[model samples]
Target: MTEVLQDLAEYIEQKRSDCVISWGFTNGELNISVAPSNITSFVEFLRSDSRCKFSTLVDITGVDYPDRTKRFDVVYHLLSMYQNHRIRLKVSIRESEAIHSIVSVHPSANWFEREVFDMFGILFRDHPDLRRILTDYGFQGFPLRKDFPTTGYNEVRYDEVQKKVVYEPVSLTQEYRQFDFMSPWEGAEYIISDDEAEGSKLMDGSKGFKDTLTSEQKIRNFNINFGPQHPAAHGVLRLVLELDGEIVERCDPHIGLLHRGTEKLMESRTYLQNLPYFDRLDYVAPMNQEHAWCLAIEKLTKVNVPRRASLIRVLYSEIGRILNHLLNVTTQAMDVGALTPPLWGFEEREKLMVFYERACGARLHAAYFRPGGVHQDLPDDLLKDIANWAEEFPAVLQDIDELLTENRIFKQRNVDIGIVSEDDIQKFGFSGVMVRGSGLAWDLRRAQPYECYDEFDFKVPIGKNGDCYDRYLVRMEEMRQSLSIIKQAIQKLLDEPGDILARGKITPPKRAEMKGSMEALIHHFKLYTEGFHVPEGEIYACVEAPKGEFGVYLVSDGSNKPYRAKLRAPGYLHLQAMDHMASGHQLADVAAIIGTMDIVFGEIDR
Candidate 1:
């Protein structure tokens, strides 16, 4: 590990243009934090440096540390294409300040950076076009910051003259937003330096002619806004594309349309309470989100999940993967104007939702996994039903494949569209099918096995041509692989008939037991009130989520609540790939490319 860190340090040192602040090998992986000012330079170094040819930007996100001197931290996770290694780089800046953008270096950073700016108020310097990504325009204050009010910083009123809604500033003096801003670092007294204040004025110049272009002219020449609500934009994502007619000169993705300040909310809630929020992060695959968070908490607490529970987790996660991929394939086809397949896909997904309800009592927001184990054991009949579905899915899959996969029209629309090369994949740090489609055989389940994934026999599918067609094929193959794993897990579940809950107090007593037994009642009351404590440290647990490697980096301060919780959603990374994939393609093909990427806005915005 020291050797690896030293090598990484040397590589960073050699790439002098890239600002490398501090780096070390932690949790069996190399982690580095760089300044955002050198984001483009750092990305170039990662792409060119032989020892650190980190071809892919796996994740880009922003963390709000309102109390800290550096108010926001923009984090980038990179994967080495040659070494099969991963490293994290973080660049922190004041919440009100703009850091250098990485869009030019890695097109995928466009959306991710915008998301940071939108939610946390961490500006990206030199961003082609930066606007509100998630929240409605004219929305006041960054919602993700600890100091920001939750009820909201602005009040909307109808504009009679403008024929649209308008925002008026709400008083920060009254804490109406459910946020407690008692920290010394918070409040309106915090003013920018004179130079920065001047810079802000210049950037926001009212007389600037550069901002006067008509909407049609903007799309025709350089600047293009794809969607605040475009059919292909997967969940209200808006992209400001700087195009040179048929070729994209530069693209900046504006995200945050779904921002709810989830991380901030997580900080206020107990570890267990945060589980439900994870379900909303990647609404398409709640099981994977739940599993990732649980795994992170488990690592921090050193909780022992039962063998049966592990098997159950694996089974549910695989089912979630299959469900997510099905949605991706069906939706991609639908976005490209092929509507029949989505209906067929939704039918299959509806059946999976039924299984989800039976397993966890909720369809999409199934808060199934607990820190130590699952919320409840799978019923015998439910397991049997899942097994039956797994058995029958292949035939349905074949039927869908026959109808859509080989259809000439579908191929014509998707075959060469949205092509992302291996180098582009690495530069963007993408994963799951996006990276795999580019011929990089990288899957978290295979590379860094979690749960009982090491015991399972499965193939990590890769595609030769990283295009829409390859992505479609990869998703289909992955569904089949998910089924195989599900079958194997079902067999294991049948063989292992033991307690699903761990031999500890992590789980609350059942309602019936609590009503009957005094001891059980006490345990339940204590569990609910105090919550379980975890050891002081941090753990980053990643799972191969449907979109990519979804990771949860959780920090526990020996409290019932997590000190900090960070979600590394793959959709955010995949969304970044859009600028690269959509560039050079006609404006009409953008929708098809966006659909093929399979991004969920909930994940991206969060």
Candidate 2:
């Protein structure tokens, strides 16, 4: 991988001019500094150059350095599916400076640039619609900035006399409290360290609807909001649809209703304290999020996880993947009027949640993943439960397939409904099912092979067409593969058992060791207080999450807490492709498209 990246870097240097300011490797990944002036050309070069076809725009975010003259570092993460490599480009800019938007190069950049603008107040030039994408409609100040207050400036409450909710200046009954570094939840346990609208052209160069319509016959489309409420909208997602009667002329996804400032909170918390927060991102697949974060921290601190811990992490990650896909498929069915799948599917989900409870205390927010490994070892019976479920899940999948995959009703609603092409997949930075459903064999677990995924023998399932039905099929097949991986890992764990947590500065001292040894006690106390210091640097680590490639970008200032934390939530990126897929389709197909993507609003809004 490093060799491929190095070759690509050399090629980029030869082809491009002053666009690349500097290039280096950190945490086994490539990092390049590009000039803000030439970012558009540089990005285009990366996407078009054969030697460096970094066609996918993975993420666009900014990190704040209030003291620096250039207060913000606008970062773009790119991936080359052709070369199978990833790169990070950094361009320093002041808060007042506006950088060129890569939306024309990669249409997925629309919302991402909007998110950066919303969070850091960084401006983007030529971005079609650059408004606050994640914050409240009229919210003031950038919450992600270091100087922003955690409590914020205002609060909303229902006004009894006015009969509506109203925003008012924040009034506190209790003042903001100072930390004494005593709370266990807030402390760092000594872990080892660790768009749119091609309206009339059909976007495929097909005949335009307007070309056929006469002057009086031309339909005028009106915009109507779909959600920000319950029902079919999925979460707080509001789709402002420009409709030509029932058919959707355009669809614009309005997210951020559930934004919780997750990245900002991560910066303020200790490394150990931040693990639980990752769980909240993709609440459905919490373990994978925590796993990615742990990988980044472990890379930063240079900690090697034990084989046993790796196997356990792999097992739980697969389980989380299965759990996530099950809910996705079932709810997808439910969204399209098939109700029985979720009833049967969630039964299996509940059983898996029991396994989660047995492994860690919490079922949903299982912050089980730690810097070096997981919080604790799995119970002896947990593998048995997994094995039993592995045997049982095939029948469950078959039942679901019988009910939805082949049923004429399911096929009618899903088949050829929301078709996405290979070019669109790469342009939108899709991963997991989105690419797989489009018949691309691009599973990060196989391509990048983090944790013990390389050791497991499982296949990456793919679909022939990028339609709604194909996406559903890919997810169903992926769950079976996940089960296969889980069984293999379980067998390996049974054959060779070892310490789950790696022995390092990050892992806390054993209770018995602490009671007997003064050094052990001191290590525990110090780890719980000041925590472990990480070498000053940056790393972007990702895992093949259920929805897509969930990544964590961490910058350490040689402190216990991360200096900057940016999460690349795949759901957020997938949502950007909504308008692309939904145009010219019926408005009712919007729910099917969203459900097929299996987006968790927690991650999207974050």
Candidate 3:
């Protein structure tokens, strides 16, 4: 694979000599640095070339290197389905510059470019609908920029007299802390000074639809707010739908209400502390998110996981897969007027939550999956409980399968609704079940194979029709496959008895050992306060997260803290396709589409 990537990199350089600046491999993935002006042509070559069919646009994120000559780096992660290879393309530009948008080549670039503009104030030329994405409407500053204060410039609240949401200058005072740390991105010190903070306060210049259009023009297309409070909408997911009486003309999802800047927050904290933050993103499958972060760190540090820990991580990840699918498929059933599925499914979810609580002492946010391995090893009794659950879990799945698979009402609501064609797969940068639901068997576990996944034998489910029902069916089959994987991991866990965590500077000494030995105690103290430094490099690591491909684009400048940690959340892409999917459907079908896509605002807004 390494030689093939190198040869391909040389071929690319030889083919497009003007566009290519540098090409090399980082963490076994090919990375090409291209000129900002020629990135569109370079991307076109990579996508359309027969040998380099990098069709899927995985993610686009902006990395702010404040002190550098070129202040911002726009990164594009692309995956080649035909070749089973991935590439990262970068274009470095100054603060005032703009890059050509590749929406003409790959429609997936539309939302990705919008997010880059929203987070870092990076402009994209020729983007049809480029505007604020993961921020408040008319948001004052770019939150992800290095100069921006963590406590953003503007905030919104519901005033008593106004009775509607109102935006105002942020009132909170955050005292600066000077840590005397030099970050290439965050300038010479850890604390951002007031002058530097002022640089990030440029308000977005885009006008709202009502302000831009005349009353006569507005009457042709009626715009209505879908929610922040509507029972049908997902939590705080508000959309501006341009309706033509019964049919939706356009669906503009007004997200960012839950935007917490998880990536920016990761830069301030040590890698150890950052693991828990991933849990908050996809709270439905907390451990799976942690697994991706841990993998990135483990890959950078070159810390080898013990066989026992590898199996344990796989076990928990599969459990997360089942948890996410159950919540999505069941809630989707409820969205279409069935009440019984949620009732029956929640019972199974409770059973899984018990396993989480038993393992990590937290049912919801089990920050147990760490960089070296899990926080601890699973006991024999807990393994027995898991094994017991594995056997009995399928009966509940069978009951739900029987109830909804061929049910008259269930099929009518989902069968051909919210159809996503095979071409729509690459256009929306779909992954996990969303890609599978569209008849593409593209799974990171099988395609990329992280952790101990390569050792497991499992079948990837493919959907026949790319509709709401096909997605539901994919999730259902996925749960069963996950259950099979869990059982296999448990068998391997019972057989392999060794260190569950890695033994090195990366992994901490056990609490019992810390009390006995002075070396252990000192090592434990230093490990938590000032974490071990990772050798300088950048790596894009991903796991087949419950909803889709959850990735961490981690950059380390030889520091205990990450320079930048951009999370490539699958929900964000799924949410981006709402406009395309729901534009022709009725108003009520919006909820069904949202549920089928498994649109969790935790990861989406993060």
- The number of the candidate with the highest lDDT is 3
> 2 or 3, which is superior by lDDT?
3
lDDT of 1 by residue, 435-519 (tens): 8888889888887778889999999888988888999999999999999999999999998887677745667876788778999
Error of model 3, residue 565, in angstroms: 0.4
Q: 300, model 2: CA deviation in Å?
A: 0.5
For model 3, where is the 10-residue window of minimal lDDT? Answer: 200-209
The alpha-carbon RMSD values of the candidates against the true structure, listed in the order shown, are: 9.5, 10.2, 10.3
Q: After superposition, how far is residue 438 of candidate 3 from its true place, in Å?
A: 1.8
- Find the candidate with the highest TM-score and give its number: 2
Better of 1 and 3 by TM-score: 3
**lDDT score, candidate 1, position 533:** 82
Model 1 residue runs over 4 Å out of place are 1-47, 60-75, 90-105, 123-132, 152-232, 238-254, 509-520
Q: What C-alpha lDDT values do all the predictions have?
A: 0.77, 0.85, 0.86
Candidates 1 and 2 compared by lDDT, better number: 2
